[model samples]
Target: MPKRLRLTRRFPVAMTNDAYRRLQSFAREAELTQDEALTFLFEHFNSVTNHENLTARLRLFRAELEARKA
Candidate 1:
């Protein structure tokens, strides 16, 4: 059985009408409910952060090095 997710945060966001329409179109095209689309987006974003966190950290380190040189 799939585990149920307990939502912990509620934040309000504002989007332009164009963005709203595009999101609706994507949900229809992908056959995803709005909640499913949001979940998918969060999962993908987390995956990218997991993969790139080390690289991002290294970039920060490089930025500090350049700052010290300057």
Candidate 2:
């Protein structure tokens, strides 16, 4: 069987050393790339939380930060 192609984009993020290490461990255990691990986490979190509200709040917070920087 042929492998399916997946389109992806680069998304750089900052994290604490401990968090980074934990994510690395998770990826290794799941046999996935860090990106895949992050995607899994995000989807799980969304399912457990109010995803739309969280996304709106995050967008607003980012906009405020950018406005302050400007």
Candidate 3:
């Protein structure tokens, strides 16, 4: 049986529309609610993420963030 999860934190999140759409898609594909999908992702972050790819993407996003805010 799968372990049950209790939501212990709630906070506001802000993301680009593209990112939000991707999150919705992932949640639908996984048959989980958006919150649950986020929880699962964060919980298994290390195992599911590609470290090199994430590092490169983070750099790109950070570089663009300032421009996006304008």
Candidate 4:
């Protein structure tokens, strides 16, 4: 078995009460520590943002092709 390397860093952030509550609820539901919950959220956000960027680029390319054909 291969050993895994761990690199941990800390980031301090301040949020509104509402945001804190939402994060707390998510952490409880997912059975994750606050740090883990935040990591999950960051990863999910990156995926969604990447998908949106790709979709926007595809739309622009299709529009350009249609304009050139006309």
Candidate 5:
């Protein structure tokens, strides 16, 4: 039998409208709830992308943080 993964944590999050919209869109397209989508992303994060590409994107996102918040 396969082990079941249970979602038992609850937390508060504040996101920019754009970020929230992106998450909503992703969840909708993937046919998963937002919580499940988030869980899946974090769980598979390591295998999901090229590390160098992710790092580059992270740096670019950091630079855009101020503008994104405005």
Candidate 6:
């Protein structure tokens, strides 16, 4: 049998009804339980592409800030 990995985290977040409904819809479309869908998203957000995008955005913002300072 393949080994399994487990993670535990705790946090409190507030969401609007619209956001909750969208998450439900995504869960259904992806054929995952709501919790599973959220887990998938958490993993996705940590992916290389996402990290690169965030880095690019931060660099852009820093450039703009530096331009203002100069």
Q: Among these predicted structures, which one has the highest lDDT?
A: 3
**Considering lDDT, where higher is better, how would the candidates rank from best to worst?**
3, 5, 2, 4, 6, 1
Predicted candidate 6 versus true structure: per-residue lDDT over 1-70, tens digit per residue: 9645354765676675887999999999999887777877877776624777889988997889767567
Model 1 earns a TM-score of 0.49
- Candidate 4 segments exceeding 4 Å error: 1-7, 48-70
Candidate 2 lDDT over residue span 3-68, tens digit each: 553637667798758879999999999999988888777758857568789889889978898675
lDDT of 4 by residue, 4-56 (tens): 53427787898858879999998999998888888777758766467878789
Compose the digit string of candidate 3's lDDT tens values, residues 1-70. Answer: 9887999899999998999999999999999999999999999999999999999999998999899999
Off by over 4 Å in 6: 1-7, 46-70
Point out where model 1 deviates above 4 Å. Answer: 1-8, 46-70
| Model 4 lDDT at residue 55 | 86
- Those runs of model 5 whose alpha carbons end farther than 4 Å from true positions after fitting are 66-70
Give candidate 3 regions above 4 Å deviation: none
Highest-TM-score candidate: 3
Model 1, 59: alpha-carbon shift in Å?
17
Residue 17 local lDDT, model 2:
88
Tell me the TM-score of each prediction against the true structure: 0.49, 0.52, 0.89, 0.55, 0.79, 0.52
Minimum summed lDDT over a 10-residue window in model 3 is located at: 1-10
lDDT of 1 by residue, 9-62 (tens): 667867758778887887888898766666667877756466678689878978
> Candidate 5: deviation at residue 44, Å?
0.4
What is the per-residue lDDT of model 5 for residues 11-63, given as tens digits with 9 covering 90 to 100?
99998788899999999999999999899898899998799999999999999
lDDT of 2 at 21: 100
Candidates in descending TM-score order: 3, 5, 4, 2, 6, 1
For candidate 5, the clash count comes to 0
